[model samples]
Target: MDKHGAKIVSVFSCKGGVGKTTTVLNLAGIYSLMEKKVLIIDMDLNSGGIAVSLGVDATKSIFNVVDDMSNNRFNTISNYIANYNENIDVLAAPKDPRDAFKIDSKYIDLIISTAIYKYDVILIDTTHILSPITLKVLDKSDSTLFMITNDPVDLKNARSMIAIFEDTEKKNYKVVFNQSKDTGKDYFTLFDIKTIIKHNIDYTIDRSFYIKDIDKYVIDKEILTLNKHIRLIKKGDVTRLTKIAIALLDKKKNNTRSEVA
Candidate 1:
């Protein structure tokens, strides 16, 4: 979509433990601060945590909506999302893992389209696996954020995927290095990482963003960007994340209408 138009941004990673979900939540927090209505869709069907981490009790999930759509029982987007606050809602992943497999990837376009008009931005947290579902999410996304860490294996895998994006001329993707995940694991410098991956690091969350009590925040259902102490303690980090969110909002991209609908 064009700048400021309703758009979907997909956050995925080379692997599962790379802080992909955390980035999504923090971006949603930043968007809320900007007073933009946001929908956070947990597409990591097997073990998504956006709903649980945010403490939003979603009775109907993405799977339910997809199942309803597949059976011609789907109605409106209102029936699926769980309200986190006035500006934020969540379309959770399946509560049961098996339900994930039953969700048809074909309906992803319809799911996103049904809700795109109702929100200023949709942040989709997808599984690291490149399943059919993930492929469709990437296709529908206005931009994709690839989260990476300082791990050797993760960087290697990222290099491979980013190479493909480069070869295919996918300019709508960004590489966000999450140094906060394992603060002490900064074996490779930023220069080395860019050299290895052959892609510039679009954003970096430094070790300063790392929290020793991250579990406490999760337990208390705290969004780091929304927490006063975190905002104060990690002021630069918060500002950096806001920049990423703002970039996603400002980039005029993927304005073409839905082909599936």
Candidate 2:
């Protein structure tokens, strides 16, 4: 019971290729399995791939919904929502990149407000660019998961972003280090990252957990379904992801309770 009616979590990164979308998909899947009503909004309008990654048809998208909104199409948000399963829904990005420009940033507030009433949790997968739309999405989020990697460039960009966040007093953020691989060689550790960014790394996801046959999974549209014959390592990865989802939900619940008090 979030005070805002729904808990919005925005997964963002200043750098790309850090597995942000993958993280959103897995977290949404885990929450869905827990019987939570989850909605994923692909805010990466220009090159969003949430629908394609999940192998779902995107006949209608946020572009259409926002276009309708601009034309006073109230209560039509549900029309563009695509069902991923019984527990999860998606508002995909436009099929054509050019259609993204038709959407105005002002409509984001309305879109999010509509989603809050329908979803228990809204997961926003945003583009790496810091456009006005992205800023609005971040401002509306209850929690922001900043995705990063072990790469130097990623860390540097994250540090710069963290500085901006601090300056703006945006404290509702958790840093997630993705695709982390340790070769036992002399490499930067979590402490080093914290020291560099002046913020603690909240979580680390192993690189091995990234599906090698991700393209095939997308084609099969079973990215969320766990295979019975999956290796033990993959199973462990799923368990870890479930824990992360639970933690996020618990945090939201606590925040809601505090707000009510």
> Highest lDDT among the candidates is held by which one?
1
Show pairs that collide, candidate 1. 1-254
lDDT of 2 by residue, 1-261 (tens): 356477888899988766788778878878777788889999999999899887767999989888777778657577888888888889999999999888888888899888797788999999889888888888888788898777677788889999888777787777887763332322577788788778888877766576656667667766543444443558877887777777776664433211100
Off by over 4 Å in 1: 1-5, 252-261
The TM-score of candidate 1 is 0.94
RMSD of 1: 2.8
Model 2, runs deviating above 4 Å: 1-4, 180-187, 230-232, 251-261
Report how far off residue 248 is in candidate 1 (Å): 0.9
Candidate 1 per-residue lDDT, tens place, 31-122, comes to 99889989999999999899899999867999899889878999998998898888889999999989999988888879888888788999
| lDDT against true structure, model 2 | 0.78
In candidate 1, residue 124 scores what lDDT? Answer: 97
Task: Report the Cα lDDT for residue 239, model 2.
Answer: 81
Error of 2 at 106 (Å): 1.1
Best-fitting candidate, scored by TM-score: 1
lDDT of 2 at 255: 31
